[model samples]
Target chain A: MTTSPIADALRLPAGPVDLTAIETDAKPGFDGKKADGKGALFAMGDELADLQERLWAQRTVGSERRVLLVLQGMDTSGKGGVLRHTIGLVDPQGVRITSFKAPTDEERAHDFLWRIDKGLPPAGYIGVFDRSHYEDVLIARVHDLAEPAEIHRRYGAINDFEARLADSGVAIIKCMLHVGADEQKSRLAARLDNPDKHWKYNPGDLDERASWPAYREAYEIALERTNTDVAPWYVVPADKKWFRNLAVAQLLLDTLRELDPQWPVADFDVEAEKKRLAEESPVQ
Target chain B: MTTSPIADALRLPAGPVDLTAIETDAKPGFDGKKADGKGALFAMGDELADLQERLWAQRTVGSERRVLLVLQGMDTSGKGGVLRHTIGLVDPQGVRITSFKAPTDEERAHDFLWRIDKGLPPAGYIGVFDRSHYEDVLIARVHDLAEPAEIHRRYGAINDFEARLADSGVAIIKCMLHVGADEQKSRLAARLDNPDKHWKYNPGDLDERASWPAYREAYEIALERTNTDVAPWYVVPADKKWFRNLAVAQLLLDTLRELDPQWPVADFDVEAEKKRLAEESPVQ
Candidate 1:
């Protein structure tokens, strides 16, 4: 469902995904100044909305195709920004957003992917994962939450899980929002400065921030190991949030456009129905 | 989902859907001749399409509400007509239609409701069944497809099945499209006369048509036994196909309006998202 647009440059090449080689403030596609970019973003939003409505309409009559946008980013890497700015353009009813948090007691009891299976968008939906199954490999690897042997096992499991979803009409678009350490610090400082944002500025985010190098190393390994043909990975630069939002929007719009779902053919006899309606209806 | 509009007159009273007592030609809610009724039908269509899109949108954002429209009638009772005219008014993407045929080996392997379970629409969807579980009682009784004892057991099973569906945010609207024998005979003759409609004119339909009285008795027994508060049956007079379409559309529209789902609140920190976007986004 993905097209080889310029946005594909944002994707990590197969094998090892070198974090240092990828720019955290890249703006390859957007040529305009911020004002023009924002205008373009709004225009993209309208197109995304129309495309999403068409997707919903196609699915309503029984198309089984779907799209999933998997977003993985560190604290203040603009995952939420992309959500609010890009995915938010589409109607919420056609969008399924799952913000994976600390596992609940019931979720903890099941396998890591169990909750993911439950959260998948049904056929003909656009699903956004704020933080997803990638957490199992990323956080778990950085913190040594699982055994080394088990972590490697999960990589294969993740690939298989994504493949199964893809086989069942899910077009997976995985994104890693790349941010420089300096950019992260500035965003964190801004959060602390704003009193209203105190609610969002979780103290634990600082704890995770402390493990930054480990987390980035973990992400490189994840992107390399789980970067798939069925579920391709895109590395969006997060230092410039506008660029990040635009790239993500363009990426999604490109995929949806490629899907190009149509209105379903009428399942009933159209001519007979028209004739019946004409005969029965007393319209002049 | 059955509203107490003037259309309520079309519904068989709670006791029994007495096929004999009910007049098939009655157009209770439709006041005008064919012309006015057609105008009203188009108005209802516009309203239905809008409401259905809203429903699809609401469900996309994680609502578990849905509607299951179970349609049944003797052959040529305008089930296909309703699909083309009324349900067609709604976008195909939001509607899931199931035309249940004779149970497959896999379906028959499980209990009767297994196929139904596989076909129930997900939340935020409108599911239409051209012929549904009612056939378990109606056809199985008249044609001796299942045992008399098993036929009685199925009624209880069906009640339990619909109750489970209703409890899980599905609004069930079952309609028995009632057509008088003479009306059916004329419609069948017209189908024979029209070469274009030959695709719809099944030779097996004539075989079923021959056992009309037996099917009527079986339907009478089935309707009386299974009508519950959770999934009530609305016996729509189908001799006037226009009235049938309008009544069904009105019923579905009224149900969706009653559900009246609102757009979901943002799950993210809105003000914080706005702030971050303002700071990081170079846009004025």
Candidate 2:
């Protein structure tokens, strides 16, 4: 597993995680400007594609290995952008992406992880969660949706759940797209200006924006508590959309390379199949 | 919808559909060579991306309208390739792809369309079925997996099912990727030759290849029986991978243009929300 400097720089350190200390607009490890970042992301496509296919091919041999990307962020932090730019590099057939929304009555009835379990990638898939179980703590804490005791307990429950997933060969990459309040204001205004983007805007977003400080505190607490070895969080500086995409793409490529999934060898005799095809099934 | 000459030429006409009569390698309705074909398919990307977004946005307003592309082809006919090259053009978020393998015990216990119902795309999404319910007729007829009486009944059942989907706002584009015998042999041989592709090879594919005549006859019968006014089948010549991808992309583009999903209007007062963001939510 080759090391990536960006992954190291962005990976949350063990102890308290402060969102204010992280530079939201700075490109920490990437050197070039926007065009170069775009080119770099696109360049990673081939290797990323190859690794994804290899991982997908593991299913043919009944291997249970897979990768899951959990994306958590405030609205307008470009979680959707990462999905389009980063995860889009690979074949969609090999991908299983689930964007979690507000819970339905059926979902709210069960433990939070119940719906999460249903969305997990089967063997050999690269699964992505747009907003994940982390929301149970972030939003639940910020809005006091759940009891204080329940919300506190969810942090440990999430770590245990992710640990079990890792034991079963699911490599989890958790990203917190950390955008500043000022950057988010501009993004929301832009969404309002463009009719094409209005569908993405929710009036309720203003209510959330009003609670930025609370959300930040909620996020810091969630990150510090749930940052486990099995699924550590990476706080991405997301004020620059291009850099955010590039950083996430690099993170995905690094994880896939570390997994180093091999193309499965033929289970049957190759030579015999070749001869049989030539002799018996010669196209009529 | 803009007229696509390819769609006109490929659309299975009313009457008996004969797979043998179509030229597998011909690039009908395309004026250019291979490089031009690739360029054209890539150029379609921007428009495809925009149309997909608009279709996806429709869900914000509770629109059930969506598009479903059904790909039915023999092994090595490039169903996976179409998924990678053609369907891969849109954001994977809006596209729900289901590659139907053999039914599980539960799936087998129910009627064939039962599983298909579970795979339908929700509001504001584009769904692709790598292989779909057509298999119930094609594979069922080829191997006599079902009784002749049951196989005959399935054709009508399929048409009824599709008509119901169309009524519920599914714009269906069913494509039958048509590859010839020599082409199939070469493709299967190529799979055998590449060690990296060994995982894709199955000895059972050879058994299906041996029954080429049976599968072709089954396909012809199924195509003829299930071709509906609401959901038409287009026989895509699959010997040339580029042309197959180009044709399917054009078919999809044309369908989306016809749907002409408008960007949903903001349900909230935009100016009020903008003011609220600027005033009440001024960056903490």
Candidate 3:
């Protein structure tokens, strides 16, 4: 309902989308310096932490508002980085994070949303999907993993699913980190070049990267079809890691500020209860 | 396996057991002071944290060692406290916690372990189950929720399941926080007498307490049948909250130390990687 400059600039276009037309190097937020951006992120991170605490406490005495942050991106676009930074700012008890991977045989037997439903945050908690149901269209489409008719049905399924969640008081935030082919290549190469980072660089990623043009087309259509007012998508320019982090953080901070949850009032008589506790013997 | 003095003292006896015979105030590893117990717990907590870090990092490179810490106890027995204190010492990214509550309609339709198997910690993670399969014997038996024959069948099934996990490289540490009726009454009353603690105090807990004798008998039987060389049960004297936390932390720290996972050796050519990385454009 309210606008922030970063949100306005980064939200996907209303009409048809062309991935090639967007600049992947833009920084809509802080002046372009890693130190300044990092500094600003942590500072905003503290505010996010305080708001998160209030959100958690409010739920303890029965407030119903919750948040679901869905992250989608190509390999090396830093979905893990966003989760580590953003969730690191909140209490682990108050946040539920599920990093969806290749579906299991059991998961495949059911509808795509079965596991997603299980991972939804209980009231007043922040739920994050590191990669989400959007993958059905992204990779599944790129690899011909599903029928074209099925993939088409899934886009509508996702919209209806998100609409149902919104009706039940979930505030949805979805982001796609827009990294360039060259940027992803350099990141993967950096992983190869650092022994400590080796585990993170999967050889399979290069296989996925080989199909970048097809994946990009799938993403364009997916975004155009699924970007609803209820759960719109934001395309974050991620060639600069710091700017990407900043934009995502700003989006969360603004969205949470609008929710403005408060701690619940105590329901019992404070004085009488304190006296009763004093009368009970201490631990033996 | 090497033994810690605390483990030797607290590990459940091999045969039939009486809950009443055990002292609820023993601090086997600590001097008789809250400060001393708290200090020693934290000292061991740091050691656990370091070992957990190595185990997590090692798995990223490739190590099969993983830990499953299953905590079983009645209400107000400090399972949540143990989770908060012990797991608070480890990286959240490396620990997978599943706090099992009552089974849902879907969960009840399958075998009891169906959901438990789904939640088993992946390789390289420490999995903590707040309540576990043992509940089938404990609550199900006491409340007449299942047939005696079904409960009898479940014990062998549980042992088989644990053996499978052991064969797959999972180290199991199961503990029962042995709090006396007096201690539970005091804790429940403490909740009732504090306005801030009211949410934790369910009035139905009193109804459960009315069946205390039956529950105790059920727990004694459950512990007897499930305690094995592969996955032994430790009955913690949990009337003293500090001692309970210290004993659980000491168990985890000692178990992890024995596993002794280390950072994996890198598999790539370091010198060549450094040279090739120098040729790529630096992150701008």
Candidate 4:
């Protein structure tokens, strides 16, 4: 069966998705969902594994092209799930994941990019950032972490920072995992109720929930200002975890396929090396 | 079955290991083979995963404690395999991986720790470094990446740096994956002969192989000097990939088990929250 437009847009394989399109008072107004595509999702997962291995093999040649996947989202928006499921499918050797947290005393002493610049993946490697530099715009704006005037400058600084990264041969894929406030509340409450998940509950989460509208506005501004072609942000409907994973994986594959990397051929004598191996073996 | 003492020391699971002990004219060595008590090796891996999950759960409560695992070894040492297998066992939500490469112009402008400090795992998280600050003492000392005088200073700098990290509540685990030169040659030759593996063969690797004695000397000095009580270095026999994975995992598990973190109980009025959920139900 052919995939529908929404399926293709979400990068889900040919299958049904159990989802509902809902409207919110937020500026974007609505989000769409498809039926569950678990089968195709797992199949695409396998394909992602193969693609990752191929990319890893290419990396062995020490090429100078890099890939960076940045994940931005509200709490409980499935960013962690997407990262876990997708990276699970790649060769760990060629993949690196960096999760940015609140700045420490030493980190605050330097410019914001100081920490980010060091975490860039090496050439021919895949780097995933869970909550990246956009925090400067989102949290800083919402929580008033920085002066209001300084926050305005950070918007421009972030745009230039990402533009420079894109120009430097890094294919940047920024994903904004979008989940409704109600969905987030459900997930957060679930964590509180479950004994095994009790560790994942915090009073501060409720406080953040109180400022959801403000954070949403901040997110919109951040996306509009910094979403350039080089590192455009894809606002993903993340209420459906499976679909989100499939979408991000497809995006990664589409990007890597565009690179069309080849396994560099060996210049040395393979036969001689094999012969040497045989000579050293007792079986001979 | 109970594990053997050496197997226990190496942290191998209950399985056959392809043990090979090597002895040069000056020194004797061992190879990969089945050993008794290998199960103990896996104990650490399990402990690490438990610790990681606890840390991840703590993030919701805003408790930050960073855990850094640093793996260093010679070529053909099982660093890749250990990383792949151990990380696979952890909850990806709370973990990040950073692989250090040759510094770019921007990175070179800062202190050696600058790049690494940026990649530190956020509090309540685990970070794995494929190769780490030890590169200053290993590669820099081996290839003269920095001046001779600078190399000596870096060793002390690294010690002080790691101590500072420990003081700041970052538990550090440093492992040296050990493999003999002969085994390295064998693995390198294997990569050269297999067309599927040809991409992994770098001609420059041969040059590094030629400097095996120097690298070994540098590593020995590094292990002797920088390994402290806060961050002791374990010389793991990495000729066997399975044993290496099991041992590293066990070490991580042991360290994490010691922390024994518990999930924070939510203090919110659960009955009120449940009432709210009911009141907010769509049917209502």
| Best of the candidates, DockQ | 2
User: Which regions in candidate 2 have their CA more than 4 angstroms from the true location?
Assistant: none
Candidate that beats the other on TM-score, 1 or 4, i.e. the better one: 4
Q: After superposition, how far is residue A96 of candidate 1 from its true place, in Å?
A: 20
Clashes of 2: 0
Instruction: Name the better of 1 and 2 by DockQ.
Output: 2
DockQ score, prediction 2: 0.80
lDDT of 4 by residue, B65-117 (tens): 67788988876786777766677667665667778888778889999999999
Model 4: how far residue B121 lies from native, Å = 4.2
Between prediction 2 and prediction 3, which has the larger lDDT? 2
TM-score of each: 0.53, 0.99, 0.75, 0.70
Candidate 3 global lDDT: 0.81
Better of 1 and 3 by lDDT: 3
The candidate maximizing TM-score is: 2
Global lDDT of model 2 = 0.91
Q: lDDT by residue for model 3 over B1-284, one digit each (tens)?
A: 78788888888879998887888777765555889888888787567766876787778766778999999888999997787666656666677888788889999999988999998988888999989998988899988778999999999999999999999889999999988877888887787765546666665666677777888899888889989999999999998998998888888887898898875665656566545545544332
Considering only the true interface residues, what is the Cα RMSD of candidate 4 after superposition?
Answer: 5.1
lDDT per residue (tens digit) for residues A165-243 in model 1: 9888887889899888778867876766654344446556655766887888899899989988888899988898878
- Native contacts conserved, per model: 0.00, 0.80, 0.10, 0.40
Q: Which sections of candidate 1 miss by over 4 Å? A: A1-284, B1-4, B275-284
Error of 4 at A91 (Å): 3.6
Descending-DockQ candidate ranking:
2, 4, 3, 1
